[model samples]
Target chain A: MKREQGAARGLAQRMGIPGPMGGAHMELNGNREAVVEGCGGILEYSEESVRVRTGKLAVRFVGRGLRIKCLAADSLVVEGFFTGIEFLW
Target chain B: MLAGLARWLLGSVTFSVFPQGGRRGAGERFFSLAARSGASLWGVRRRGEAFSASVRAGQYAGLRAPARRAGVRLRVSRRNGLPFWLRACRRRKGLVAGGALAAALLLWMPSCIWSVNVAGVSGPQAQELLAQAELLGLFPGVPRGDIDPDLLQQSLMRRYPDAGWISVNTRGSVATITLSERVETPPVKESGRYYNVKAARAGQVVSIHATEGEAAVSPGDAVAEGQLLISGVWEDVYGASHLSHAAGEVLARTQRTAEAEVPLRQTIREPTGETVERRSLRVFSLQFPLTAVPAPQEGYSCTARVETLSFGGVSLPVSLYIERWEGFQEREVVLTEEEAAAQAWREIQAQTDAWEGVELLRAEERAAVQGGVYRLQVQYTGLENIAVESEIFTGGGDEMTGDSNVG
Candidate 1:
C-alpha cells in the first residue's frame, strides 16, 4: 500500500512535465498529434495506432480497447479517414 | 461545375500542407464539402468583371468539443508546391476595401422616398390624388413584378377620374409616380320632336327626367286614360321647320299605378316570349350570313342562328347558333297602382330604346283607372319621322365610333 501511494505521487508531479531532451519546445494548444509511418520517432506509429508521449490512441475493428501513455513530438496521429490533413505556413 | 470543383481542388493544395495543425485541415474541408453540396453542381464564370464578390466564411459543427478538436484546414493554390499563403503580406487593396466599408457603415444610410406616385393617369390635384389612391392600401416598395399593371391602373383610374395616364417606377430605394389628365368632351346638342303620353290608367307620375330630348310632362302630373299628358315634340314660337334623322333622347321610370280586371279583354301576348337573338357570321370579306341552327324538340320553337366561325383570334369560315323556345303561360295579371306605374315606365323604356326600323327619340306614357280596370297610352317621337329619312344615318355602329352609345 505504501509503495503504490509513492508511485501515484510521482506520476502526478510528472503530469505534462516535459523531459529535458527536446530543443526549446513550447506547449501546443492541447491538440492531438498523428505521426507518419516510416518516420524517425521514439514511438511505434501507424495510420490506426499511435503513441503520443506515453499516451496511445488506437482504433480497432471491434470494441473500445487501449494501450496508452506512449508518444514524443508535435506531429498528429490519425485513424479513420484521410487525404490531406493540415496547412502549415 | 466540374471545372469549378477542379479549380478549387487545385487551389486547396496550397493551404493543406504548411505548418500542419493536428491533421484537422482534413476535417475542415469535409465540413465545407457538406455545406456546399447538392444534386445541383455550381459553375462560376469570370467574364470581364465578376458577377459577385463576397467574403466567404464557414463553420464546422461536427464536434461537440470544438476546443479539443480544431477544425481541419484546406490546401490552397500555391507556387512550387508550398502552402497557399504568400511569403509576405504583398498588397493593401484588401485592407483598403474593408476600411472603406467600415467608413460607409459609420456614415448615413443613403435611402429615402424620392417621390409620391399616381398610376394610369394624373389629375389636377396629384398629391391629393395619391392620398386618395393610397386609401386602397397600396404603397411604394411594392414589387412591380408582383403587381398586375392593368388591375393597378384600373384601381388608380377609379379614384382619379380626371387622370389620363399614370405610371410607377423605382430606382434603388426610391419610387416615383407620374400622371396625365383626361380631356373633357361636350355633350351633343339635341334638336328633335316630342310625343304626347296618354294615361294608360289613373296614376301620378312618380318621377320625370329629361336627359337629352324634351320632356312633355313633369313629375306628379295626373291625367285621364288616353289623355295627352306627356309629349316628346317641342316647338319654338318661330316654328322654324327643322329636320333630324335620329336625335338624342332616352327616358324611363320605375313605376306607374293602374287597376286590373278579369274578363276585361286582356292581351293574350301569343303565349310566346317573342325574343329575337340575331347573330351574324362572316363567310368572307365584307359578307355576313344568317345560317340555320339545330332545331329544338317538340313543344318548343327556336329561332336558330348561324353566323361566322371563329378560329383562334381570327374569324373563321363559318359561324352559327342553335336556339330553342319553350311554352309560356299567359295568365291574367292583376296590377295594383304600383304594377301599373311600373308597366307604364316599362312602355316608356320600350319606346325610347334602339330599334331596327326607325330610331327611337323620346317616349311618354299616360294612365287612368276606372271600375277596377286600368288603361295605358304609350307615345314615342322619331318613330314616324326617322322613316322619312333612310340612308341618312347608317354605319357599322361599333362602340369605338362616337355614335356607339346611341339608344
Candidate 2:
C-alpha cells in the first residue's frame, strides 16, 4: 500500500513540473527579475542582474532597484519602469 | 603660424593673375574670341592649379588661388594655324581628307581609263581601232607625267593609222583618252590569179553571156560538177598568141536543183492570229544594229527576239536579230508549183543578199520532173568578181596574215 501511494505521488509531481520548451509557467509563480540596456533603440539584457538603460532618445528608460518575491508557495511579482517624452499615464 | 603662412600663400596668388604667352595674329584672335564667349556665357574664367578646378563646383566656388602655371603648348600651331583649307573645312573632315585625296588624285589622276570614247569612227572600224589603241596603252591611265605627250601621240598615230586624232585631257584628277578614229572600208584583197567559173552545184547551163572569159559551155549545155562554164583565158584556133587574163564576171545560167519526194497529206496546225514584239537594242560600245532594219517587223506578225552581240568588254557593231515566228506550226506539206517557186526564190535571194554590194546576175528558174518527184532548179551569175584583201598590223593583237585560220 505504501509503494502504491509513493508511485501515485511521483506521477503527480511529474505532471506539475514543465519541460525546457515551456514558458514562464514553470517560474516562481510571482515576481520576475530582469534588467536590460536600451541601446540604438533596443532594450537588451546583462548576466549579473538584467540592467536596462535608455542611452539615447530611441527608447524610454525603465526599472531601478526593485526586489522580486522569493517566498510563498507560488510567489510572483513584476517590476517595470518606462519614461516616455510624452506622458500617457 | 603655418596656417597663417598658407593663408598668405593663397592670398598672394588671388591678387595678380599672369598669362604667359602673348596673343598675336589671327589664331590668337580666334582663341581670345572663344575664351571671351565662354566667360561671358557661363562666367567661366581661368582655372586654378588644382585638378578639381575644371569641375562645376570648383568653377562656382571662389578659387583658393588665382591661377595655375599651365601654359598652352602648340603642336605645329601655325603662325596662321592649320591653313585656310583646313580651317575652312572645320565641319567636313571627310572633305578635307577627300580634298587631300583629291589633291593626291590631282597628283595621281594621270592613271586609269576615264573616258574610253572613240569618236570620228563608225561601225566595226571604230571598235577595231579602240582594241588596237588599248593594246598600245596610249589611252587613259597612262602616266602623263612621265611621257612626252606629243611624242607619245605621234607614236600612237603611226601604230593606229585608223585614228584620225587622239588627245589627252586632264581635269582636276581625271585623265581622258579622247580618241577620233577614221571610218574604214572593207579591204579588197586581190588574188591577181583569174579563176574559171565552175559549177558550184550540179546544174545545166540554160543561157550564157561571157563578160571577160571565153565561154566554154553554150546554152542547153550539161556541165558536170567542177566543170568550167567559162575559161579564164581565150585560145586562138591555131594556138599562135598567148593572151592576157581578164578580171570580170562571167554571166552563165547556173541551175541549183532541189528534189524532194514529200508526203501529200499534211496536218498543219497553224495559229489564226500572230503576236509580234519589238524592243530597243544595244551592244556595249555601239548603239544598235547597223543592218538598218526599219522599226519592227510589221505586216506579217512575228515573235520578237532581240539579242546584243558583244566581244569581251567590247561590243560589236552587229547584233543577233532573230524573228521568233510566234507559235506557228512547222507543217510539212506537198508543195504546189507556186509555193515551190516562192521558196526557191527566197533561198536564192537570201544567198544574193550575203554579197549584196558585189554585182551578181540571177536567172529565171526552171521546173522539171524526175522519179515521181518534181525538181526545182534556179540559176545565178556573179556580175563583178571581188577578191578579199587584208593587212597585218604589229600591235593590233591579231595574228599575221598567213597565221589566221580564216583565209
Candidate 3:
C-alpha cells in the first residue's frame, strides 16, 4: 500500500498536478484563521499551541487564545492570534 | 452562526475527556478515533488534565468506544439544544399543561366576537341600530359562525328602508356595522282633490301662471294674506262649473319685518367649583357602577367619556364609562347698552334667517335702547313664491261656494 501510494504521488508530481493524498496542506489567513487538510490527527492541544500530524512530520502552531474551530477525520480549522509555525519530524 | 444554530436544533453535548493515568495526548487520540467514526467536534481546548469539546448529540454515544480504546474517560459537562429542553420539560408537567391550555385558548377565543362597533351613525340612531342588531342575534360573545354578514345586512336594510347602504363586516373578534341613511323625498299630493292656491302672506303679485285653475290675480295686483292666487273653481266651455286641484306658480314681492328685544339685566348659569365623578364598567351589554355616588339631580352639567378595552388591535366588549358633573349657580349679569343692542340684532338676524327660499332685495335695521331694554327691528323686502295649497270643501256642498269671490 505504501509503495502504490508513493508511485501515485510521483506520477502526480511528474504530471505537474497536485495529488489529493500527497501530504497535508495548510492555508493561513492573516494571523486569525488556519485550515489544515489531510491532517493525520491532533498531536497536542492547548491555549498556547496546537500540533497536527501530516504525512511524515507534525505542524506546530504557537499562538495565544488558540482554539480548534472545527475538527473532522482528515481536516481541521484553527483560529487564533498566531505568532509562529514550525515543522518537526 | 448558522452552523451553531443548526447544531443547537439538532442537539449537542459538551464533554470532557480525561486520560486514564494522566497520560498526555490521550485527548488527541480520542478525537482522532471519534472523527474517524464520522463524529464532528468543535471548541476543543484543554483545561487542567481534561480536554473539552462538543459533539453532535446523536454522535456522542458512538464516542464511548473510541474513548475506551484511546484510554480516556468521557464526562458530559453541559447539554445544549432542543432534545435537552424537551427532556427538562418532561419533569415539569404543569408547565407543559399550562402552555398547551394557553395555546388552545388562543386558537379558540378568536372564533367568537368580543366587540360590536357601529360606524356612520351616532346618538339615538346608533343606539337603535345596535338594538336592532341585538334582536337579529349579532351581539358580542356570539360565535362568528352563527353570524351571516349578508343576512344581517339584508335584515337591517329591510328595517330601515331609508338606508342608502348597509354593510356588516366581521373580522377576528370585532364586528363592524356600517350604515348610510338615504335622504327622504317629500310625498306628492293627490291632484284629484279640489283645492285653491292662496297667498301665504300679503304681497304684491309679480307673476302668476296657473296650470290647472284660473288665475285669480294679475301682475302688480295687491293681495292680502289668505287671498286666493289661483281658483280651483272654473267654468268649462259648456258653462258647467268644475272644481279641480289648483296647480300654479306665483312669484311675489313680499315685505318681511322682524323685531327682537333684550333686557339689560339677565340671569345666566355659572359653574361652581364643586364636581361629582361617577365611574362605571360595561361588560357585553350589562353595566355596573364602580362609584357609589348617585348622579346629581339638577343644576349640573355633565360630560361623559367611554373607553373600550382592546386585544391585539381588536376592540373588546369591555368598556369603562366616566361621567363628570359640575354644579352650576344662577347669577344676574348686567349688560351694557352696546352689548344688549348687539344681542338683539343677533336675535333679529336669526329670525330672518329662518325664512327660506327668499332672495333679499333690500334690508333696513333700526336699533334703540329704551328703559334698560335694547330693541332691534329689521324690515326686509324680498321676492319669494307665495302660492300655498288650501283644500276646498266639496262634501255635497255647492261647488260655487268654494270660490273666493263667493266666500
lDDT of 2 by residue, B1-407 (tens): 66344333332111112234642222222222322223111111222311110111212122222122123221211111133335468779888788788899765544433334444555575556556666666443445454454765676678767667777444432333456757677845344433445554444555566555566667666656555555554657986432223333333334333223322334566664564434444432234444444443433446544344545544333455555344454565666756655555676566666754444455555666555344555555443322211222223432222312111
Looking at the true structure's interface, with contacts defined as alpha carbon pairs within 8 Å between chains A and B, what fraction does model 3 recover?
A: 0.79
- Native-contact recovery for every candidate? 0.00, 0.00, 0.79
TM-score of chain B of 2: 0.33
**DockQ of every candidate structure:** 0.01, 0.00, 0.52
Listed per prediction, chain B TM-scores read 0.24, 0.33, 0.52
Q: Quote the positional error of residue B297 for candidate 2 in Å.
A: 30
Task: Identify the runs in model 1 with alpha carbons over 4 angstroms from their true place.
Answer: A1-89, B1-5, B9-124, B143-148, B165-178, B186-407
Name the lDDT value of residue B84 in candidate 2.
35
| Backbone clashes under 3 angstroms, per model | 71, 14, 0
Positional deviation of residue B395's Cα in model 3 after best superposition, in angstroms: 32
Lowest-lDDT window of 10 residues in candidate 3 chain B?
B398-407
Regions more than 4 Å wrong, model 3: A1-17, A25-30, B109-112, B134-138, B141-155, B169-172, B180-314, B317-407
Cα lDDT, all candidates:
0.37, 0.40, 0.88
Candidate 3 C-alpha lDDT tens digits along B279-354: 9998976799999999999999999877879777556789999999999999999999888878887898798789
Residue lDDT tens for model 1, B24-143? 233323222322331111111111211111111122122213213334333323332112233222356677677678888444222332233444443456546656545653443333
Supply candidate 2's per-residue lDDT for B31: 24
Ranking by TM-score: 3, 2, 1
